[model samples]
Target chain A: MDLSPSGAWLVIVVASLGCYALKLAGWAVPARWLEGERLQRAAVLLPIPLLAALVVVQAFAGDRALVLDARAGGLAVAVVLVLLRAPFLVVVLAAAAAAAVLRAV
Target chain B: MGIGAAVGAYGLSFGAAGVTAGLSTLQTCALSLLLFTGASQFALVGVLGAGGAAVAAVAGALLLGTRNTLYAVRLGTLLPVRGPRRLLAAQLTIDETTGMATAAPEGLAGTAFWATGASVYVLWNGATLLGALGAARLGDPGALGLDAAVPAAFLALLALQVRARSTLAVALSGALIAALAIPFTPAGVPVLLAALAVVPLILRRRRET
Candidate 1:
């Protein structure tokens, strides 16, 4: 792959700064603002959908249409492991193994 | 737990991608250490891989990173830093760290949050360096479906977050937005959209009480 050195560096710098800014914004803001009843309630519930959407996209979206091949299998295995309340290490290894098998076969 | 593992593994793939994108081992490690944001790093590399303009890729990453603002707010309260600790704590703040911290029982929240953040930082940078060095021998992560690891891991994380009452609405909205936007948007954009879609639901839920 042909990567431009200067270009990549620039992206890294800007992205890092942007990330820092977001973190700073939260810290710099007054605590009372976020502690409001309504915002607090919203915060508790917000990760659900945002994380759900991420899961769906990761499991299904492919270069073409949705693929239920190896990736999906890996996801399924991870889901089962999670249900069983397995340790994080086991779940990751199992998911990766499932994905590898599905992709190979 | 699931989200942490899955998201962490995604770091491995990002490491692999970083190597393929012509980043050296040191540079890749630096990226993970400095940026520490998976979505942004992935977006940066994805754009490079696709021959997209560098500036556009950076912009895409910045846009995706907007969600961290939300995380920072929640985590700030749970693990408020004082004196010089603030600087280190701020660097450690990420989705996983913040999530673990915010979810933790009050007294234990600070410790759990720091542990999670430190662990992720160590694991991510270590894996990236390893992946960069091993990329050649690794032989096609796509063929191995390593890319799937990210979404799979994220899904597991999402599953853990589900509870009663609001589960249906949150799940449906996330699925709808992700499915619709995945094809149109770039790598980090879908996550941003997912975050944006939740805003109205959050606002509406607030109004109900």
Candidate 2:
């Protein structure tokens, strides 16, 4: 009952179209509208919160209940690497290794 | 162009996760080619991987995608692209391309955008296929801790953007909202609703100056 092939394809199609529409809509927005501080601030601030939410959800989700295990350790390792300004690949591998090692023990 | 491999690495994780989440390999590759943003693609698969409803997955993905619209708006003034080229520019308006283009000297922004975007597209799609094909052999990404890749990747991305005080505040509040909602809401709903946590701060800043 998860995303089937057909279902996955549908989401891809809709997401592509919707994403394009957002680009077009951005152009269509009047310069006057963007002149408003609130509208502009919301645009800038939106991803910060949204991506944080994604990080939380992805780190903790488990079988319809929230739990933390190796994933948290992985996320923490990622935080340290990222703060150290590790390259993107380094951050990913170290994080995966951290999680894998934690799960192994 | 060298940075396209960033997309490659990110795409590989998505491929593994998408397949684990029950999407076919073709389906996962299609996502990389079509939707083309790492965060949104991850949001869509993260939900489905958890066996959450498809509607919830779509909702979360689309909301995350709205950020691309802001990127589009920011790029418009810089690029001045029009007609068919505008569409092409829009497709290329992901984080890497925008960051590169924005950082370029005034006249080179367009070149930076295209070069970065095209390289990412080619490498990312190819890596997606590789990951999808390899997924079955890899067993559970969760066991390998590949599941943690999703959140860790998001944190890495957030680390880049959270330098500003306002952004850090929004991120903290958003995390709080999502953490609180985890017990009460469905799997993907916390992410979608967490948008509300930032609204007041945005509105308040508007009132401030």
Candidate 3:
């Protein structure tokens, strides 16, 4: 929230460049090196935890405190929708709606 | 076409989320245009929106983007572009395009890849702009429960990647670590520490070998 406008722009530029570089590296690097089982496993395994961490931090944490409010309800709905194999947009919107409804009541 | 439409709709949320996270609309659009990766873009904005430092936000996002490289590696072999065209191929080598390309009939793979990538790019960027503008006008994102939407989006992305018991185990561990770390550590650090969840798996594998 305290982020300066320039700071935000810097993040946009740096992160975007880093991501593009990673994508290009994939194309340039030899397939044999990346195709190794261990390296491949690391790649596949890495994002799983990061994403899971994000889910927890976003849903449960509140400014260095774990406080569950409407977001939890929203996330619960998201879980259910995901289990039901709902579309990506549906899952996200349904979660938001669930939270809004919970907060309203 | 259907994939593009679905992804485009999701882009609306990204745009809205970026604004909610405190980015100017131009900054948000810049992310969609330059980063072009859905989960990483969301992670960056999500971290920034939550008041995390820019360094942490960039770290989390860059980590998330690494998977795109893996996608590119496979696509490089399958498609085998030679020179400057490789730049376009690498840029378009995202999850959706890779999925469509890999799944297409042998003769139609190239067509499928280009069509899906280009269409999704257009639709997603257009929708991101729309969502960002609409959200900027809405006022009070909490009233609409948009705050919760961020986590929900992450959950959806996470759900897609969890197919094995080990991956699920890792996910749960990551969640626990992040939740535990939140109260003690800084905002972005918890997510970074959560990546430590893999240590147990690594140790276990080491023991087996």
Report the number of the highest-DockQ candidate.
Answer: 3
DockQ (Cα-based) for each candidate: 0.43, 0.66, 0.79
Give the TM-score of chain A, superposed on the true chain A, for all candidates in the order listed.
0.73, 0.89, 0.91
Q: What value does the lDDT take at residue B139 in candidate 3?
A: 92
List model 2 lDDT by residue over B1-209, tens digit each: 35766677777777877787778888888888888888788878877776667788877777777767777777888887878887777777787888888999979988888888898889888988988888867887767877777788788777877887777888989898988888888777888788887788866876888
What fraction of the native interface does candidate 3 get right in terms of contacts?
0.86
Better of 1 and 3 by DockQ: 3
TM-score of each: 0.70, 0.90, 0.95
Candidate 1: residue B129 Cα off by (Å)? 2.4
TM-score attained by model 2: 0.90
Model 3 CAPRI quality: medium
Please provide, for model 1 over B111-147, each residue's C-alpha lDDT reduced to its tens digit, 9 standing for 90 to 100: 9888898888888887777767776567776666555
Candidate that would win on lDDT: 3
Task: State the TM-score of the second chain for every model.
Answer: 0.68, 0.89, 0.94
In angstroms, the error of model 1 at B153 is: 1.9
> TM-score for model 3?
0.95
